[model samples]
Target: MIMKYAILSQTKDLMPTLGLGTWQAPPDVIENVVYNALELGYRHIDTAFNYNNEQAIGNAIKKWLNDGKGTRKDIFITTKLPHVGNRASDVKKFLELQLKMLQLDYVDLYLIHVSFGFHCDPEKFTPLVKPTGEYELDMETDHIATWKKMEECQKEGLIHNLGLSNFNEIQIAKIIKEATIKPQVLQVELHAYFQQLKLRKFCEENDIIVTAYAPLGSPGAKDHFVNKYNYSPDTFPDLLGHPEVKAIADHHGKTTAQILLHFLVKQKITVIPKSTSENRLKENMDIYDFELTPEEMNSMKKLDKGEKGRIFNFLFWKGVENHPEYPFKLSDDKD
Candidate 1:
């Protein structure tokens, strides 16, 4: 089984191009999903503190290791710092908690999940909400300070690779300018519809490996927003069901999901598409066997709708658009 990889500039670590994304995955079933993914040859697993499923994922990894399936060094585990813990003071605290929950001495990659901050209760570690039902915004959110603390943790050998998620180029530049160590990866919402060409180019020049979250256009996200916040977008992207994508899939004798993933993987853009179904998991990994033609890749590139194609604006968090560190532009202006 051949697999593509992105080399981290700092340590030259080979991060597998395809990984298992675990956002919106319920904790109850996450253990089995993770265990099944490991059995199916997945080496990279992406999770976050806010996902609240790290403990279960830890159980799966622990069980797999105990069964003598693989050692910790063989697997790459990536988790993040939650928005509530976005402050420099909270970096080590939350990281230690995540390590404790994941039952690991260190994580392969630790990312600052978001650029913004949310005020939360210290004891519960839950984001505090205003009486108006909006998130309590932390106006003084400081990226450079938080990033400095992240570098300290990396120096202490707690995090092997340090990265950012949902951070724009400007925010990343600020960190790079202040840091002793540069960020090795940038995980963002990337798909065929919302291809971040300019951002990817910037990362390439900076030697930051870009990881794509919601790589399948996050088909389940609409329902999640509606159920959790009673908010729904005017339109939801269905990249897997698009006629153009289907045609490409049929041409290659592959599923639409496979074509979507292969299109990104072929470009050396890491993709973490989430799935619980065993068949889909295997299907997603089988993409390495086939290659999309140059013409097909061009056609796929035409699907880039830019900012309008973006699905995760984080608007469901009520007043999040007003945050000082909000990465996306809320109006007609391009980010």
Candidate 2:
């Protein structure tokens, strides 16, 4: 069963609290993954232009529709405006291309993938970086200008709702102060380790629904990315292996991953945990069947290490720290 959250929106839009994330999912396997997710009763599927698998997802959705499993209105599809397409002038063109890739005329929600703008080769949308290894930023591009274009997209029916990802408090506040429509959601790297309590509180106060990506701490994700790049920082502490988490799981007769997901759901935060295994997918969807106690929730809450536990530090975007809107400026440590 899909659990829906009533978010502050232009209309009464009940969004599914659980969604299937498409980041890092291989294009070869993504179509099958999406098809299975739909068959398993997932009503929310999250993707982005940067993910580079929208066409396969679109094909799966097309087949699912043809088979009469569900209608377009039944699913909440979300896509992002990539950092490469971050300029105000490119928003419409960027979204139009994404729509064609997804084979959809309109998306349920559209988001700015990141706050920093990337100056990319216009045709390939490839980031143009300097020889010194810093990202070439569009210093002239501003969030206010980009947001105005996003508002235009909403007014033109290209997107039903608009939101942001990886944006900091000051950035969000600036948008709120100048926006014609408030951001309906904020997607960020949230987990048991880096709980983002302060940011979550801010979003809650402002009526923006928080979607926690990497909600499982994306166990081993650190090691994979770091080893692949030969970078420093140790692997993240395993949330599923934490003694308290495991003990709580045993007490509740649930898996460790289930405990992690349940903890976030109880906090009224939306989650999109990615998995290739069918059993794991079913396990994630079954979170609604059980509940965590107040004590259990508190125990899990203590796992928060504040800014020390963030995993997706965007270190790959060289010199990202120099950006004015860099969200993770609190730490120089990369996970």
Error of 2 at 14 (Å): 1.0
Give, for candidate 2, the lowest lDDT window spanning 10 residues.
1-10
Clashing pairs in 1: none
Kindly report which residue pairs in candidate 2 clash with one another: none
| Each model's total of backbone clashes | 0, 0
Q: Across residues 161-275, which tens digit of lDDT does each residue of candidate 2 receive?
A: 9999999899999999999888999999998988988899999988899999999888647676776866665556678788999999999999999899888878889999988
Every model's TM-score: 0.97, 0.95
The prediction achieving the highest TM-score against the true structure is: 1
As a whole number from 0 to 100, the lDDT of residue 130 in candidate 1 is: 91
**Candidate 1 — which residues are off by over 4 angstroms?**
1-3, 333-335
Off by over 4 Å in 2: 1-3, 332-335
